[model samples]
Target: MMLRPFSKSGSFYKGNLHGHSSNSDGKFSVSEVIDAYKKRGYDFTCISDHLWIDNRFCAETVTDASKYNTHNFIAINSAELHTRGKKYDKENLWHLVANGLSKDFKPSNDEENIQDLIKRAKGDGAFISIAHPEWYSLTFDEAIMLKDCHSVEIYNHASTVKCNRGSGIYIADFLLNENVKTLLTSTDDSHSLEEDAYGGWVFVKTKELNEKKILKSLIKGDYYSSTGVVIYEVKLEKRLLKLKFSSSNNIMVSGAGHTNISSHGYNLTNAELDLENFDSPFFRITISNQFGKYAWTNPYWFNELDLD
Candidate 1:
């Protein structure tokens, strides 16, 4: 089935996958978050509350999935699996976003204990992502070892809340170490209602929007992370990664996904890199500013044979 074509006229859908509501610590209710994005011309959103996998709230809010699940606007359900944190009392939350899994899905913040939960969620065909690696001990070294992790968050809304120290800097650095295929996502880990924390989000390029198709695009890594900026398109070919910006502003793109990849400064509105390209497995991208603050895109895996 052909999904609704992405905004071909350069319009992009904005979504926050790691949002919280009164259900957790967020100030707004689910309805409030939806209304907020709708006002900003968002196509859809995922209410990935903390520690809960049940989307019954989503179903209840929309009432009719068919009507709301259209080309323009839709609501999806997801959860943020918690993990051990640096402090003994505070839990290190590792998010595992799932789609049609059983509502019984549970998240733990017990350091490595969340591994078992992630394995089970992936086994049941859920879309799982490692939350902010810059938070606790959830480093890229650990994420690389975890199997079936379809994606990782390059930037988190709450990252700034953690003194901007939780932005997945080290994770992006390690992406250059080995070729690991995984999608990258950005979420507004919102806990307050007064602020627009949904600053970081993904710009997906699918023609249609639905639970199935949206999740599929995410798993395939056909999305880009953004913070007040949008990547119109990204294509990696013949040891080159080409990126087009939606707006022509002085932008910076830097990150080490694979080894031996070096980048030249921006040539007008585009950035070019001769990074060691991977034909198969995952490759990563980082876009940022001179200030060292930026967003990370999930590794877009290239099939060995498809790299022609």
Candidate 2:
């Protein structure tokens, strides 16, 4: 089966799942952040400011449905939850992005256990995402043990801006190799417009642009993460995995045991991989342009199929 985002009927909506405002340590206010994204042609945005004592879901106060929702834009209620972890050194922390949360939802500040927080967030109907594993230098053993997370950030714009260590593809690859099913996301995690905003986003395929539909699509993995390149379609039939994309200089298929199939050229629009003889447990695709912009597809698990 194809691990694709688009279906036959729905349109694609561009959105950033992680972002911050003055409600936290971010420089921009909630209104200003919303305005910036709307002007950038984004269809929706989740103002996921930090959930802490001082911040306290401050973005909620500004997320007025009538003021932000229009024929062209939407605002989603979200937050970044940080919990104390003992697996790593004193400085290391566990950060999770909780999407589609209630405005009045309260997180336990006294909760120091990361796993417990994840469970609570899942119970609250929030889409949980492990955020910036690379930034925390999270090990595979540390990350793979966590449960109830829908996705992980393949790229975090804010982490990249601060330390140039925001990509988490290694952690993702490790989990996929272990047959743990999960999706990937690219988020701005933007705290400032100049350095972080609009750097990463996900293209969600949904029937409409409303908050509920968009969040549903996100949790269902009906999305592809991108830094700049655009993927038009991804399809799988029998043993062939095909992709239709915008201009890209390189298209690659990555899988277990260092399996890699790649095509490099100019003005490339489509690519295909024949997986009939492949034995990898899972496989995913990435497209990159000459300028280093990238788009990634969610991994397709082979063990789940009756490919006999």
Candidate 3:
């Protein structure tokens, strides 16, 4: 059986699932952001401006950049939602990114917690992600509380270059170890404050380049997050896993605590691993090139694929 992303049928659409604009604290306006992303060769982009009450860095309304949609490039309505009651945040706020949201999505008041916020966003037809967990120091308790969300922000480029804590690898693995069944995401979270835009993104597969279809594909784990590497395909048969991709210095399979298998070579474009006795309920793949760019696949469980 082919792993999903590969199992799904569609053209791959390159996109940034998280970003900011002048509607929030970002430097550029919606149109400027659109022009910038299109110039970078993105098929679609989300203007996920901050949706909170803090006027200094947030707006109460979601950003709707749909007017800039053309025959090829388009914008998805989105917001970087926030709420209160967290252990380690400086502002005690939880950062959640919601893509394909309706413009009327409400802002969180002081009383709303993360769970309530997630439920409301999902009910409103949005794909939600736990944003920048490593950058914000989200606690294990906080991650558990949000175990039901669609995905974890596994990589955030803005936080990486700006603060050096752009990876949520631990939290994502921890959630999987806990059997949370969550997906993974990579985002720029760009404010255009520095050289942050286009540094990270997700390549989603869908038949149409519209918001509804993209959101549906995202929720189904029909995409791969990347810093630079591109994965062509993934397939499994008779306990052997095969992957095709661009040149990479390292390719590895990561699983439950301390369980990892790897193969390394120069300009290696393909590799296969025998998982016949690999000791883990779930597995994920990682590829990194010489320039330090990485690509990650969402965890797939053995039982879910009827292989366990």
Best by lDDT: 3
- Candidate achieving higher lDDT, 1 or 2: 2
Worst 10 residues of 3 by lDDT: 299-308
Q: Which of the two candidates, 1 or 3, achieves a greater TM-score against the reference?
A: 3
Question: In model 2, how large is the Cα lDDT of residue 35?
Answer: 93
lDDT of 3: 0.92
The residue-by-residue lDDT of candidate 1 on 239-282, one tens digit each, is: 56676644332443343433334343432346666646333354
What's the lDDT of the predicted structure labeled candidate 2?
0.81
CA lDDT, candidate 3, residue 276? 87
Best by TM-score: 3
* Model 2: per-residue Cα lDDT over 29-109, one tens digit each: 778888999999999998887774434434433233235678889888888876666356353456789888777767546
* CA-RMSD of model 1: 5.8
In candidate 1, what residue range of length 10 has the lowest lDDT sum?
1-10
